[model samples]
Target chain A: MTRRKEKTELVPKEKQPISSQAGEPTRPGVFYSPAVDIFQTEEDLVIVADMPGVAPGDLNVDLEDSVLTVTGKVDEPDSDWKLRYREYGIGGYTRRFTLSDKIDQSGIEAKLVNGVLTVRLPKADALKPRKVLVKAA
Target chain B: MTVLRTHRFNDIWQEMNRWQQHMGDLFGERDYSKNACGVFPPINTYDNGESYIVLAEIPGISLDDLDITATATQLTLKGERSPNNDIADRSYHRAERDHGSFNRTIDLGQPIDPDKIDARFENGVLEIVLPRAAHALPRQITVKN
Candidate 1:
């Protein structure tokens, strides 16, 4: 028997649920529709995005005034159809997040390898754990 | 000696060469809009005794748009995704999907039995299975005293 997942997780259709009531909705030029998994280690935050059909040049990553945004676009394939069984339409992807002062914006990095977009944001010096040496009294 | 420290540093440095390259590329530019030029996905290859499997994630694409071709040593996937040309004059509250034309090609490291390849597409994922040549299989041997 063939088994399939009922529904894949999709980005929330509402752009910003919190900000919607505050003012007119922000028209985010680049929408990050890609599925991203965010993780943090002792020193940095890592964001892994699953952008299967997207290419390196097609990716746009921006860190501006404490906000991080990632955008991508993927094209469809060409095939002759006997009948329509399934449809996953083509659309652009957009994601945005407010940056924290503890992050080192200068050291943040992004890469597109193997259809995966990995963004690493290092923690700033002040945010890092420090060990103070005690002097003999 | 300083030479020893330099050598060790060089090993670590080279090990991180890809990381540095990627990091440099990441922070160098900031673009906020769609990219006019198109790019393709990278391919991965894995082999076992019976077959080799290739997997690619192709979201927001219809199965009809894809064209898969296999040769003795290569497998090619080509397709185009046309943007929503239908929607007009409505300001989108949010847009987070990518649409465009892309082609991905993977070179099977070893020669494969072209006639035995199998392919399946479902849920925006494409999988290609390539069987191994008969000679590539391992054979049993007897130990000598």
Candidate 2:
């Protein structure tokens, strides 16, 4: 039987861990599948991901061969602190996204604020809706 | 390292849970909460000599919208995440980030000064520092001859 958890909470969603995907990771640390929201408009496709404890400098967004990967490296907590109560583990975040040819790769832009990363991928010229002059018959 | 002692019910429960987790790890059991969802903005607690720090990961939330309350033994965190554009306006390919509001009450296990509890949001994590209550702190009495 598939283990499916009932959705009850309105705001707090559980963190999702990612199993190894494709190539091996160069850095040794725990990885999580960050919660993301993807919205597509007529002009652009926006991808927003939640990655807490990741500074702007620590975030990486790379797109190669139509495969876009987002990785956020988090700083490790001080080891001197003793763990008394535990709910989640300390680690980095990584998720892979496959983009289509319709997206303009050069137009991609992303920014991180308050632990949220938003990536804007503009639609290619061919994909954008063009208004053609209608010759009246 | 000296471990703080508290008689709260949550402390015992957490102790037992840690023990179970330790045993589970020994048996190579898969970690729970991995790929499984839990409460919003999962929290982890840590302790130093002077204070206990509670860290909660909250992404995309403004400090103005968040609320935090603390007592001698418990903490309450409340916040709301604003929704994006109207659902009808944009086509969402994937919507995994849950939104709305969340109120999480945490048991600190030890008595806190409450007045000294300091909380700040940085890099999307809500960090709450709960100092040990004065009465709970240990003091060495000098013996006069």
Error of 1 at A117 (Å): 1.4
Q: What DockQ does each candidate score versus the true complex, computed on alpha carbons?
A: 0.03, 0.51
Worst 10 residues of 2 chain B by lDDT: B29-38
* Tens digit per residue, CA lDDT, model 1, A9-112: 22222212223444443554333356555656677777766665566777789988899988766554432211111122334466677878989999999987
- Residues B1-145, candidate 1: write the lDDT tens digits: 3555233555776868756766756995322111212334323344545777765566445668778888888888887644333323323322344445666566676778889989975434566778877776668989999
- Score candidate 1 by lDDT: 0.59
lDDT of 2 by residue, A64-107 (tens): 99999999999977898887666677789998899999999999
Task: Give candidate 1 regions above 4 Å deviation.
Answer: A1-32, A79-84, A133-137, B1-145
Model 1 / residue B39 / CA error / Å: 27
Q: Who wins the DockQ comparison?
A: 2
Model 2 has fnat of 0.76
Error of 1 at A20 (Å): 12
* Candidate 2: chain B TM-score against the reference chain B: 0.71
